[model samples]
Target: MGRLRHPGRYRDERRPERACRGRADRLLALLSGLAPYVDARFSLLCHSYGSVVCAHAAPLLAQTGVQVSDIVNLASPGLDVSTVGELGTSARVWVAQAASDRIGWVPNVRVFGVGHGRDPLDPAFGARAVDVDDAQGHDGYLVAGTSSVRRLTAIAVGTGDAHSVLAAR
Candidate 1:
């Protein structure tokens, strides 16, 4: 229900499951408890490392029929997209990355000696990519009035499309 800044705390090695899972479990349990009081329309807005947490939690939430209305990921490091396909199809999934982002230019994913390539702008990724004209590295996402913020805000409100994400840029 609320925006989680650091989602990976639940599963990342740095924090480990014990430390973070309690909070996540408590949150999920609370959501489950409050599901009857609230409407079904809901979403999980994950940014950066938070996407990883959402990816891990999707299955458990599914079992509870909580229904993920949408997933908005911004300047993400791979959230294991292949695993996401298994996450129910009802939730509208979206992703946005700046064009001039140097950090995302390289594949941040590596597994079993194989690595996934960069495609923050690839249409096949099934998520719209918002473009940024600035050639800055990873943290260029917070430039106030830039296209990145505009498109990101639009997508977050469900008012933007692929073209709108890059409009007038």
Candidate 2:
């Protein structure tokens, strides 16, 4: 997991960006160490800042011959790259954003290297956007009985397509 220190409300904006870069570097190192031991294809399920870490580490992991089956980004703040293809993995990238999630309201632009980048759920980002009907907010996707949780579970286990999951309910 990315060790992003949650700063106080009054902290400088640059602190989070710095923290994210550091965490991404650490995550890349960790993935380099772990890739050799992963005998089978794997998947990544990331939330918030964790998605940013994954985005950075994925290219390096791909270089090590790690086959990533899927990458699920839930309520991501944004990713470091403008396009999901920059991740350099053949993984099926999935994204979810609750209708009521405040995080979704954040500007998707990166300014002065502060914000991460484009929203993953944006059609331009090239990710499969999943429907999160029951998720009420940024954190509600994890709550039991929420449609978001069920849909995510299905995607994680490779049982169904994200769009199909929404249609089934």
Candidate 3:
């Protein structure tokens, strides 16, 4: 799954999960249609609230036979799941957040049943940490000259391994 045009801003405040869940549903239909063309499971690279959309969609993709190889969550506020096990996929889960990114300050709790959930960066959360020390801020992962982009690119193309990708604290 490549980057999707999210259309507008991130999650909706009125009913966040419903919105992301709806997107996930739509994502399933899209992937279902593309399933015939996919020779192997594909990977996903998501950032910010987009990660929320992915978190909702990941497991459902498997039911539709659109297996995912990997999931890279970048500077996310939350993934709506407390554990990688909850994602229900064999795909490797990776997390990346810059040392200076303010997203680290977001409370790792859900509110009104629709807020951010577990901190994907938390070692206990079980996502493979990706080094982004070269990243300056939340959106800096893809910025030029950052080690984040280099590693992300490799992961996208299937070259980087968990052992080679830099680890974040």
Candidate 4:
């Protein structure tokens, strides 16, 4: 999996919403370069700001014939895209947000281009929600022994149903 980083440190608290268009373009280029070498369809697991980049790159990736099997968003701040269907791909969309995650308090709405947009975990956002009850906060989803990690692992490896794993939690 490729990890993306913004060019500059987004430290300005006043402008919490850093422009992600450039980052998205970089991600597109990275994925395009990887497409030829990758043999099987892959899943995208994005966390926080990375989800914003995924949202922006989804359509572009489809246009390039990238085979995306699934997209898992963990503690996403927000997504600029209006609908999951607008992602322009056949990938199954999954989302998880811990109750204790501070990012959950971020407004789901976009204003002055500040916020990304709607919460992917919202029922109306059309994504399958995974249980993260055992997660502590924004960064806890991947912690070892957590139910979130187990479900996420299942989703990543395509061995078990993520919803079923969550149900057992």
Best model per lDDT: 3
| Candidate 3 residue runs with Cα over 4 Å from true position | 1-12
Error of 4 at 35 (Å): 1.9
How do the residues 1-169 of candidate 4 rate in per-residue lDDT, one tens digit apiece? 5566532355554554344666778777877887787767767888888888778777777755567778888889777876799777688888888889999888888878677788887677888888778999778989999777888888887754744654322
lDDT winner, 1 or 2? 2
Write down the lDDT that model 3 would get: 0.81
Residue clash pairs of candidate 2: none
Candidates by lDDT, descending order:
3, 4, 2, 1
TM-score of 3: 0.86
- The 10-residue segment with the lowest total lDDT in model 2: 1-10
User: Per-residue lDDT for 1-169 in model 3, tens only?
Assistant: 4554342445565777777787777777877888888777677888887888888888777776777788899988889999999987788888898889988888989877856798998888989989887888777889876677999988877888867795936
lDDT of 1 by residue, 57-168 (tens): 6557755546666776666666555444654455667665655555476575566523323343455555544555552556666578876667666765667676776533
- TM-score, prediction 2: 0.79
The global C-alpha lDDT for each of the candidates, from Candidate 1 onward, is 0.57, 0.73, 0.81, 0.76
What lDDT score goes with residue 46 in model 1?
A: 62
Indicate which candidate wins on TM-score: 3
Clashes of each: 0, 0, 1, 0
Instruction: Kindly give the stretch of ten consecutive residues in candidate 1 with the minimal lDDT sum.
Output: 113-122
